[model samples]
Target: MTDQRAPLIQRGIVDLMIAADRLRFQIEAALRPMGINLTQMSLLNHFSWQPDRAQSITELTDVMAINQPGVTKAIAALADRGLVEKIDDAEDARVKRVKITPAGLEALGQARQAAWPPVEAAFGSLDDEELAAFTSHLVKMKASLAIS
Candidate 1:
């Protein structure tokens, strides 16, 4: 006999993907007016958290889960826009570390304001207990995947 649990497992995975996609779309739409996508916003958010800590491209690759070229390109674009800056590492002049500029912090604040409504609306229907459970599940899954 076929495994009865297979369909249940597949449906759960599919439902998670669908929900993630819908949330992403809503966030993207909300951020479009600011001329940034989730990935860029994520980069800004990372930098904003520790404005003084300059992180290398390799570090950013791990955090953003994107390839080096993409990170480099995004950094270049943000640098061009005066949102981020790349400076030579103190110990390693060959390596460049990126940090958020004051403008980036300002943009990040604006982006958060723009993005918060959609995120709040998406979870507004969930009661506190339900939301906490959902978050715990997501955290467990992320840990299982070794995502930082």
Candidate 2:
């Protein structure tokens, strides 16, 4: 039974991975004209979802699942582009928090607009019911992995 299930399990995982990679490529292509890459747009999206549009380097590292140096580098790049600013934490002077500027939000909104068409295209074949079921299954898988 285990041997029989192995192929099914492997195929399922591979299909998901390939789908994700293709979607990522499409999104990246969509974002290219806006002078933003996937990782930068992802960071901007994360900040937009935050209450204060701000987070510490450590927090960003944890959420992005990247190393400290990488987070710092991305933050610096955003800062240089005037999309985000690093501020001294109110309570902890030693900790610097990165906050999105108004321009950052504007860019994020534009990025979303640019990104939506490809995403919609990807799902356009699915009817409403099918889309909902697909999304529900994805949510369940995310939950199973304890991902938010």
Q: Scored by CA lDDT, what does every candidate get? A: 0.91, 0.88
lDDT per residue as tens, model 1, 1-148: 2789989978999998998899899999999998888888889999998998899999999988889999998888889889999999999888999999999999999999999998999899999999999999999988889856
Candidate 1 segments exceeding 4 Å error = 1-4
lDDT of 2 by residue, 1-148 (tens): 4798899989999998998899999999999998887788888888888637578999998888778998888788888999899988999999999988889999999999999998998899999999999999999997788625
Clashing pairs in 2: none
Worst lDDT 10-window in candidate 2: 45-54
Q: TM-scores for all candidates?
A: 0.90, 0.87
The Cα error of candidate 1 at residue 5, in Å, is 4.0
Query: Where does the lowest 10-residue lDDT sum fall in candidate 1?
Result: 1-10
Q: Which stretches of candidate 2 lie over 4 Å from their true place?
A: 1-4, 51-53
